[model samples]
Target: MDPPLSFTVPQEDFLLFHQVDRDLYKILVTELSRDPSESMRLLAMWLWLEKVGFHNVVKNIMSLPIILINEIADETMLCLTCLTNNSNTSLTTIMLSSEANDIPLLQSVMENEISLKFFRQNCMEAIHGVEKTRKEVCMRAFGDIMQRAMMRNIAERMVENNNFLFGSTGPINLQFGSVGIAGALGQQHSNNNGGRGGIIPADERTLFVTFSKGYRVEEWEVREFFTMAYGDCIETLFMQETQPNEQPLFGRIIFHKVSTIDMILKGASKVKFSINRKHVWVRKFVPKRTNTDKVILPGETSGFGFGITS
Candidate 1:
């Protein structure tokens, strides 16, 4: 029986065999075997070898069994022809057109995580003989493959935070009241409870405002003014009315950042700024006790210091 083919071909050369002809095949094989560790460096060397006259090196390398040589050479030639004809073909088309045994090798090249320099230097060099537009299309295909590989790697590393709301420190023990009967009664007697465990505390970023007498607070006007003053940091702004058929006596403003509350309070007091030309007092909101009486009597204030009657 003929001696088995002694040399194991590099994966890249196997994928790009069509690009190698008899005149340049020897140089291509030599370059691919230069440094076993650097795949991309070897690829660059293969692309640099120009097609010249036949040499003794080519004869020696082709001394392998006729059957094996013809198999690889034929596959390479067919792949090269397909690529040269359809330079702008998709990667899938390139892979599908290749011989069945070579499919895995072609897939490996398409999925290889090489740098942009590899595509620009080696990949572009392989298609140097093609038209400029066709060359660009080929480079773009290679670039798309690299980009997809990078995105997939990034996505794999990104672990979803299951406890994002509570945070990674673990679930917080938010106690409604202390443990025992006293705690239960304390919670029950607390007017802020509203028949629940405890009153929902006001967000630190929110501000409670009491408008000056004879000033009718408009929700849109307040929102527009605060939005202009604070830019996008003002998340929410709305007027609060306690009595029916009456104008809004107060308003609430919630900021995107809690740190901005102190800054705004200090600045508002210093400037003596008012919303809609009326004196407006602003302070951090404090959760209030729930009242049984739904309606605010004409002259009574709702403990927030804002009177219904001017």
Candidate 2:
């Protein structure tokens, strides 16, 4: 006995299927319409979905028409690339580009599952372009902020210790020598002193630290080390040459404020710290008023300049 079999979907079930499809379309449009900040949150959700092996859901979202895909920014595209589990496909490059408008490529990606090597190459180029644009924007914004902040005299003084302004914790190399904006400002302030080369006022505000005898150190390393110890209080540091024929072997650290110097000196008259296992001695730098002023060290009968070994 043979009986004809008939299958029919209930009317209510058919209506429910259409409702779900429409809801999904609305959700996708809403997600694409979000701002960049909100898009980042959505990206995190998409990444989680991908990690959980929700491939179909990811495919559906990514394969949206070109008009919908173009609404997303390049940053969002980069985020999407991080979740591509398929070695054969670069969904980011395929779906998030001007080439998405190409009918043949779009059809191949959507239907035939095209796997092109150039997709990865183009994706990398787009990512790099986005990064370069962001970096330039940040630098320009920072320069503008500094210009406004430095308009006031006090703020300009603050800029001396703010490494963000000069790009690092050391002196900027000028044609004359390695010097900082603080040193330049000090030189300008002391213009009234006349003829004698600009000398920074020596008090508790400055320290003359001698490195281990015969131990060589780079200028940047000294700046970085001291900056870590003193933070923004350590405005500038430079090597001092005690003898004309000898290489500069000592570092002079200048504090941004006299108060910081007083605080450090009160804790210790002389400090002993080590850099790379080599001993360093730190003492307040007291500048001599006259050329004849001299210092005598233990076991040495003749007087010499403050930092001179002999």
Candidate 3:
């Protein structure tokens, strides 16, 4: 066992391309078994690099120093190949630029195609392997890679898909249970069902539902519509219209307003309602105990996924 490197190396380049320099790899492997102190220290540094979009920052740390070097060589070759293929179009542009402003043209057209591919390939592998991570240490490293990968993939796909729905839709949409029922009507309803057992109060129930096409609902008729839908008044129904919020559950929902109906009627076809707000938080009177048995947790339901509220 050898001593570990004293200082941490920033892996911005390696993170994007998992290309650990030869000297760096040697240090990681030598420190891995010799002394856990140095190994852990360097490991922390490596993990930080991974989180910040440095893919395969530990590429040099393998079964052995020699094997590590061999893997780097293999990866370098693969990356070079990917770069070479990608460069063909740029190379053609370069050749055409001889009669034009070659400097600017070259700068704009040429990039390290091989390095980019190598980084993407290795980084994606590490990211996808996140499911195998058991420890928090490993999880952080994998998380960084995955975040970068997803961002890149989504950005690239957006460009490729050419989904330019600008101004055509608002960034967010808002919805809420109808508040048309006055306090008097609400009290009357409660009085009528006062002592009825199992009759949930009108204000204590909320429905997680979508609005009709062409509108973002602000005030709904509790007595006529939602009362029947929820079967009672409830506080706080996590309603998601358009698409469900995926993380950090319990936030306002934002959507666009595609259109509005003075009176929503049935038989609306292919109606488009643009999102008006990104998130809308609506408060309601929910019963003491909400039902979780019917609400499936994420990963438990086939397509519904999990929900803390559920």
Candidate 4:
């Protein structure tokens, strides 16, 4: 298996817009005294629309003013918070909202195994008439691939430790095809602990929080994540969650793009071993505690991508 490539986005942008959406929903509905059961049902269905393979339903009913029904900021935040905070149920809500709007975010899932490429490709076909929508969908698909790779990487690490509790073998055992990032992670709840605390030391304890068996690392694109930089750097394919300080608490990637196969061939290129090279093709990062800021040294990356010999 090859390494996964990830994309980094400004965390503030996502959290901020989500807040606005939450406020909007709260203000519109709280005053109308709408049917509580009806509103709950709508919210549930909306989540399924994005997280589950129910995009058709979402496309059909998304036009409804579910949020506009309540206009109170507090109310909106409450609803949004509920969906965002509760992983088991709320993951669908987060996925739905993000998918409906952000094409890049949606694309991150394409790298995961849960969904066949057909759905995204169909979306491209359907939206080809609209240039703007087409571009958006394409970007979303790309982002989904990146995110899926990251999720799979994290899941693989956890599965090795038998850290996840929801599934005895592993969360990847269950197949809930087409669930978005949050939904996938949510389904694979850990028995030991929840949140990002269960990630391996190499991953800096930040959990991908998704369940999928997409961690095949030998592919070219997957190799790109490791070759682009030799130190801690953000991925271009998926967004990582941040702490309150907005610093990434999880592992960062360093990539170096290898143009000539010779660069890879001449280097010591064995997995799990280190070789000294002026340059290397790929390296699985291992963070050291020496620096206040985590940075994988050039020598370290060269050491890891150390298997290929001339």
Compare the candidates by lDDT and give the number of the best one. 2
Q: Estimate each model's TM-score.
A: 0.28, 0.28, 0.17, 0.16
Please tell me which model should have the higher TM-score, number 2 or number 4. Answer: 2
User: Alpha carbon lDDT of residue 12, candidate 2?
Assistant: 52
Candidate 4 per-residue lDDT, tens place, 1-310, comes to 2122122434455335334333322322332333332333334323333443444333322222331122112222333343334454543343344222122212222233222122233333322222332232222322333344446546555664563455453333322222333342222233322232322122221211111112212223333433462322222222223224532111223222221222333443212212222111122322222211233322232122211111
- Judge candidate 4 at residue 110 and give its lDDT: 27
lDDT of candidates 1 onward, in order: 0.39, 0.41, 0.30, 0.29
Looking at model 4, residue 90 earns an lDDT score of 40
Local accuracy of candidate 1 as per-residue lDDT tens digits, 1-310? 2232212555455335433332233222232121111222222222322221113222332433222222223333334444445455553354443232232212112223222223233444445533331232223323333344446434423422333444433221121222342332212233432333442233445686555434666677767777788666665564554466665545567665654676677744322346767655566654322221122221233443343221
Pairs in clash, predicted candidate 2:
none
Collision pairs in model 1:
none
Q: Who is ahead in lDDT, 1 or 2?
A: 2
Compared with the true structure, model 2 gives a TM-score of 0.28
Candidate 4 Cα outliers beyond 4 Å, as residue runs: 1-15, 18-116, 119-310
CA deviation > 4 Å runs, candidate 1: 1-202, 242-245, 267-272, 289-310
Residues 70-189 of candidate 3 have per-residue lDDT tens digits of 223333333333323544765444333332212211111123122332333454443333222223333233345334444654654464344333421111110112233233122223
Residue-level lDDT for 295 in candidate 3: 20
Candidate 2 C-alpha RMSD relative to the actual structure: 25.6
State each model's C-alpha RMSD to the native.
29.0, 25.6, 22.4, 23.1
Clashes of each: 0, 0, 49, 58
